[model samples]
Target: MKDWDYGELFEAINESYEEFLANGRGEKFAVARAFNEYANMGKIEDIITGVAIGEILASHDKVFIGYIEGITGWLSEVGKKDLKNELSDGEIENLLGRIATVIRDLRNKPIDSNPVA
Candidate 1:
């Protein structure tokens, strides 16, 4: 499996989010396309893609909530069997919620930039 670049992953998501905001909601969500691209890259890529999606959900507006079912359906269409199974079991939302919780908690914590000498 190729080593996925986190920068690229986040960049794709950010660009997609910007597009979603610029265009009306009627515009197809580019983030799902990004997820589709990454999900096919490898077995583990879906997990990373899920994390990216969760991060977006964590920091961004609630607009994405309305698209969860669509995203879940898209993933079911293209994701691996294990992912499909998880989606079928209706656990993707739970997983995303957990990931978002972790992201939200991390974001809430302050970073200490200065190191003790």
Candidate 2:
């Protein structure tokens, strides 16, 4: 297994987040479509390639809703009202965490030493 570059991962996450904001309702859909295209060509990291599919497979809105509830609680406790949205920032953030975890976990999986390209 190779060491993962945390900085690079963070940068990717930032880029993805910007994409989400730009696309709004189609955010995850867009990421999933792009990720799948790359994964099919073996051009993306495995964990990232799997995220959207994971949510789709889980098939439960509540799981995602819980994420929002948790975030709302934190914001309320701190008196930061703006971060607490009805849609659940915590849930979306949880998805982000899942994305991060998958990438980190992929770093431990056996992979071809050569770049996919």
Top TM-score: which candidate number?
Answer: 1
Candidate 1 at 107: error in angstroms?
15
User: What's the true lDDT of residue 7 in model 1?
Assistant: 46
TM-score, predicted candidate 2 vs. hidden true structure:
0.28
lDDT tens digits, residue span 31-71, model 1: 55545555666654555566666455444334343345434
Candidates in order have lDDT scores of: 0.49, 0.39
RMSD of each: 13.2, 16.0
Colliding residue pairs in candidate 2: 67-90, 67-91, 68-91
| Candidate 1 positional error at 25, Å | 1.7
